[model samples]
Target: MSKQADSSICAYAYCSHEQTGYEKHFFITPASLLQHVQKLDELGYFLEDITCMQVKEGFLLTYHFNRWEKPGRLALRVLVVEEDKTIDSISSIYPGALWHERECYDFFGIVFKNHPSLIPLLLPPEMEERPLLKSSEKLRDLYELLPGCEQVLHAPRDEEFGQFIKECSQKGK
Candidate 1:
């Protein structure tokens, strides 16, 4: 999907830091990943790390970022399916992503396009399979791993999520 469409289809979901380990969880697309990350960069958020997991839908890449002034972390997620296992390199915005990206590549076999060096960081160059990837039957949806999302992932009302976000925003203030 186009970046605009990907973003327009979903709204940001707020999570409690004390209860969920993060303040906000955003579900974005690979096409829109750079811009969302660029905005965070402009706001002085630092890239903590990049992690990846195999999900029933696809490979879910979670980019974790934080700021010294902020009290909690924020996660930006992009789902990459088997047909296209690539994402834009964030090393340009946050140089630290260079190493983290390499690690993700090493295990999950994700291709970070335009990366300075896409070589393996931990695995052997001859490794044929992505060690972190599991068989199809073992994969699970991203929502299952997310706290509170399980309660609402199947909820028929957007109002419920909107209200949760509003409450979280107010509590943060």
Candidate 2:
């Protein structure tokens, strides 16, 4: 793989080029999420949708972006620690992200900071608990649900993924 591809793959714990048939996925930190999205926007990538997954460590947020002209998709994954449960909103960069982020918030209880209006998109506004929050015991590991994610899951954080990839690359050398 090219260095760029290797870096992208190593950035995320559960990234897979095969998962969504996307070209690549970069696991990013919550702090860098906006910067990534902004860069993609400048590259003319449109926001497709944002999906959230509840995990043992926290909620995994995936922002799917694609370019119509080039026809390539990229998934940017960010893990928000459970206690914090928040991340910067990309709605400013991609206006479409607003609705998707709201929906994610409605179902996963993730707060998108600076979102113009982060209200419930699908459920009743009064609902207290997010319907999609699952217990860790009931939640299956990413590898179990997505084949090819086994290696990815072993390093659940972005930093760990980077270190794992670095070690693997050095060994191959």
Candidate 3:
């Protein structure tokens, strides 16, 4: 895992393709998402999927991409707080995202701002409750499920993740 390659995308740390099956994984802000995604489109990556997960911190939206020639996956992750369940729509860049985004909306109640026809895809229109949301007690921090600053089969403590992030940030200086 390494720091972000450029400023356009905010990267803390990412797992290697050999280790995680992703060529690169980046943690970015919703503000910078479209610009970076446009770069990926220009680089010939096709949208594979967009998945949403509820965590202790908030909602984690991961967008997966890959190129036919390269044959490796890449991910751009953004954290949206439970308070503001919104982010810009990438359907303009990748038309296929319409379905994935809709599924996220149907299942998680995530509002994809500027998404054209942001309606239920799998669930019925009258279903007011999101099926995937867990109770607060069941929600786990992202570190428990994902690699924080590095990969480990076991979940790392929050302090470990915080220290790792700090150490990695110092390296950039």
List candidate 2 stretches off by more than 4 Å: 1-20, 143-173
The TM-score, computed over Cα atoms with residue i paired to residue i, of candidate 2 is 0.74
> Per lDDT, what order, best first?
3, 1, 2
Per residue, candidate 2 scores C-alpha lDDT tens digits across 1-173 of 13333333333333344433666576667776786667667666788889999876677788887778766566877778889998999888888888999999899888889999999888998998988889767986654554455554444445643554365356542
lDDT of 1 by residue, 88-164 (tens): 99999899999999999999889999999999898889887888989988887766665334433333233443454
Q: Which stretches of model 1 miss by more than 4 angstroms?
A: 1-12, 147-173
- Model 1: how far residue 91 lies from native, Å: 0.6
lDDT of model 3 at position 75:
79
Whole-structure CA lDDT of model 2: 0.71
In candidate 2, which residue pairs clash?
none
Which pairs clash in model 3?
none
- Per-residue C-alpha lDDT of model 3 across residues 26-77, encoded as one tens digit per residue: 6676777887788677667899999999998889899998778746677777
Q: What TM-scores do the predictions have?
A: 0.77, 0.74, 0.77
lDDT of 1: 0.73
Residue 42 C-alpha lDDT in model 3: 67
